[model samples]
Target: MNPLLAGDRDVVISAATASGKTEAAFLPICSRLAEEPAEGIGVLYISPLKALITDQHRRLESLCEHVGLQITPWHGDVPKSLKTKLRRRPRGILLITPESLESLLIHQMGWLKTAFAPLRYIVIDEFHAFIGSERGCQLLSLLTRLGFLLDKEVPRVALSATLGDLVMVGKCLRPAEAGCEPAVIESAALKSSLKIQLRGYLIPDRPHDEDDNPVDTVQNQIVADLFSILRGKSHLVFANSRRWTEYFAAELADRCAVHALPNEFFPHHGNLAKELREQLEARLLEGRLPTTAVCTMTLELGIDIGSVDSVAQVAAPHSVASLRQRLGRSGRRGEAAVLRLFIKEQEVTADSGAADRLRFHTMRCAALISLLLKKWYEPPLTGLNHFSTLVHQVLAVIGQYGGARADQLHRLLCARGPFQETEPAAFAALLRSMGEDELISQTHDGQLVLGVKGENLVGHYSFFSVFKTPEEYRLEAGGKVLGTVPVDGPLLVDQIIIFAGKRWRIESVDDEKKVITLTKAKGGSPPLFLGDPLLVHDRVRQEMFALFESGECPVYFDAVARDHFEEAVSGFREWELADRPWLVSGANLWVFPWLGDRVVNALAILVTEQGFQAGNDDGILEVRNCSEAAFKQAIKTHLAGPRLTKKDLAARLEGSPIEKYDKWVPKSLRQQSQSGHFFDLEGAYQWLERKTDFLR
Candidate 1:
């Protein structure tokens, strides 16, 4: 209950969503600041999103006012005058993001060291989002660097709605380079009843044309169901992708028009304009209108969007943590949280892949929901070599100090810092490449400073973001800005497209400014807002396998979903996958490893290295032009030969840039990082061993 409020003692408060985590953290913080006044900024509150900062500010305004403290929300969106005011007189709680904190460390070290001299505690909201990510890595490095500047310890408090890997969470909260052990405070649960149903639909095997009578559209039916279920009520629909989000929102709005009803559904995603996103947030907070936001993961976290009636998921959720987080948005005030899952499986044909025939999406979603019920989630990933963040941090350090020695950079970063997987040789090689590539320059006295190229990179606004931001074209219709889209291919002037939950006709195109002008159109498909797909965990797949192996029908399935589940089970048995590791087709093999994406990728690489064409498609490994016997032989030979480490497995990997800062790091080091993080070689190897033994 006390939160162990002692000097330099870290704490982690993990509880259910909408369970007053911010108040829990700030109560003690504000109390301490009020009871014992300190000069300069007393507390530094970090958040993953600028919107989250706004949400927290609104929630804590009255509380801070009651405690006689000022809370300043600092980010790119805040007015420069307000930021200037805060800079001139730093006091009370300074709410910021990692990027803004990075900016201060680089450009205002003199002011920051003084301002943070009396900083008592650092609080990170949505702590899970930062762990095992590039931004998270940058955050940890910034904290460590801040500690070095202060020459003393500052205790940290982390707040989250969902968490796993308690040990890893503790370690990340207080890295080896800072503070004491983290004390965890977690609640039992939400404890409310869950009202859930998974409804399935079937898409026609043949594509429908405009001339086709009685056109069968699974999407339309699903949208119709959504309109009937969510009309005149507030809800959140997780459509899994920007394309789906836009399409579903547009379809629901169109349905409202056809029925002569007010539009209640709106689209929310990363591509939308900031003002539009803020508008949606404001409407949700107003709590008057019947609003439903069809969104991607943007609304999954704890962004105070008022109370909602229910949550709907359009596709199979990638992770249990995400599902749990999305479900947490509902079931407030002692009401049962309602969930309606919509799953659409394409009609099977002769050329349909194994995943489609087996209804893999349905199985996977069922597995994730099961795990969510069991209160199990994937642990935070560790033992990764984030050379990308290391590259950014090294440049950041040089910028902060104006110039840094090689030994100091190495000592503060790779030696005793977070990037322990990087060896001295790899790091030295990276520095040499940086110098050669003009990312950094070495003076005659051997001190590292930002080169002309490095200065250009770091001075740019995009430099502050550790994650990759794709180049996109801003879309405008009439005088208002709609949203932006990444043009994957050439765009014509009269192209019709769906964006921002509206159908648009391209009026004109300005390639130089990367802007597309549009006019309202009747219908169009969503453009390619290309992004990396989520990786599925092995546990989810294992549960899917268990479902088929054990012949158990889940109670949450609807009539259509039950039919799909039964069909999938029949197909699984017919293919004889339960007895063997693969199914044999003419001159090809369908490998069912039932592992996570990374391990599947690792096996694919190994098979490809052995002179076979392989690809991991939708959790099923497809080996082209390789028979079961040949594939079996390759595995046996690999098992008998020298163990292939990550480096060895990566020998045939394409050395392209995956992270934002990968271009600056040496090719070999980049390869090493990818080799370590991109694949679970050990996990793959164990599965291979088991499969081969079963074959024998």
Candidate 2:
């Protein structure tokens, strides 16, 4: 082993997925443990997902036995007896999730020193997954607190497969003043010999009348075609949502039955029981049966499911980064990976014909694939302010320590966190807002503690996470509950809802606990497009503008996709869609300057800030009666300004609705907490810069 292992610098092992990144990270730590096996926990391994933690534990256990060290996994599912064993004889690595780590700090405050006294290194697996998220921010705060508690600098080692922005990840893991040196070990460039294939479909024409059955007819045809390709292959079919996963699974199975094929397929998503998910994973790994698992993003991560033969994506994956991860899952055994994209085509019979719709759909798929093939991945991080997460973390700190001084809390939060640049006045304003909200109570001794309301919040397991989840109503039938459906609005009696892969007719609703009783129904209802907001990086918008301007086509576009792209480009040039920001299509007017989602959001914010009535749906930013000249000027001015700093971008994200931690946190902390979420002002500026000339 290298003698430089005693150094205090962070190590980054950037290898491809399934390439022993886990072993590479753990080997050095285990080597140190061999030299000096500390009495207490010697290493901390943090993972983004609970499933990953469980998998890591098994892997670590075998290695620990080889090295004569004890390894333990501590998550919600881990038994209490195991935890007691660790507390009694703390040794080796302690695997945990961010929320579980927070629980330890909150519940086991007294054990902080003894348990972590021997801590030499903190290993964050899949560090890229945590970047630009509230969970990332929360983990950063926890790490900062742990550092403060240890009163010593801890070396952080981060392992990731696909990281588009390494600098951002470094900044997030270690602040500038911490004097931490990050070493990047990029092995992906060496190992990658990836081959990608893009598939295309034609949007079929439908009848002009409402009585036409082409929608279902077209869906059946698509499913049939997909089943033919999927059969006899051990593949993972990815759908964007759970309901779609179910629909596709059922459709594929039904198609199989009609074709007299064995019904060995399964559906795996978050809504399924843990047992079922594990069963599917085991079957896939065994490779005994010809089974295909239709799943959501649950299977997208680094969970080992053996080597999948191929991957079929249902629609356009939201971004190229996600597409790369999914595609990378296959082709691991020195063979080229195969990916088939099935785009569901729908035609607007009123004005836009099937050709136009198909061309547009084909263009989008081509654009995403082209971007990926050209080594460009979407870095569209969320732009919303995370002040709420900060609020929860502050409250969590006060709860853990019983009572903490105001200055200490502020300094600890802002000094080391991603919010290091946040001004004292803004932080004070947030604190005052929390004080006004009665979430924090100040004692006569001038210390801060959780108020009654805040105490109530921290009392629940749900308060541990900062991610926003809508208030959902549990769907039950004959005393056995199915799953949950979001309670966005009041549900009337007998309203049909589809959840957990089944359609249900509402029998009754208990509004108090937000539970809805239901019975099984025959026909499937339209799937709920749970308005998952998409962030568009300024880079993508600039690329889109480039796509419009450049005469040469992107090399990543496949032959069929390129033909469609050429058609779209021809149409855009003929209609002058690039120069004219407004084009009325069907019922809505599309304002196109080739900007991605973030700039569109900035434009929306600019409109809202400028006293103009505007709305957004899907990727379209809508405004009514606003002069074209004013919109052009706004774009030009924003483009001409100096690149937006992180703080300025975060400021733009202020005033977004608090999705998580229901009003218990102080407003100021909430704002500070939301800072780390993907509010890239520079990206926004770049996007606007590309569109300024077109706007004029």
TM-score of each: 0.89, 0.81
List candidate 2 stretches off by more than 4 Å: 1-4, 176-179, 190-195, 202-217, 348-361, 378-384, 472-530, 544-563, 577-590, 605-658, 665-696
What is the per-residue lDDT of model 2 for residues 1-696, given as tens digits with 9 covering 90 to 100? 342266477777766677788887778779888888887888898998777887778767888999898888988889999999988877788999989999889988778678899898899988878876668878888998898888887888888777766655565678635555577666744224555555545455645453223344455666776777778879999988888899989988887788787886689998898889988888888888888999998888887787888888877666777777788778888887777776644433454432353254555565666677676665425334456567778888898898888788878887776556556776677677778777788999999888887788888898777786567767778998666766532233444455554456667767556677888755322211223444544455455556655646645455655666676678668767656655544433346535555455444544445554343332345544456666666556655665445555345432224357535444334433443432234544565555556665
- The alpha-carbon RMSD values of the candidates against the true structure, listed in the order shown, are 7.3, 7.3
Q: Would you list the C-alpha lDDT of every candidate in the order shown?
A: 0.81, 0.67
- Which candidate leads the pack in TM-score? 1
- Compared with the true structure, what per-residue lDDT tens digits does model 1 show for residues 7-57? 457888888889888888888788888998778899999999899999999
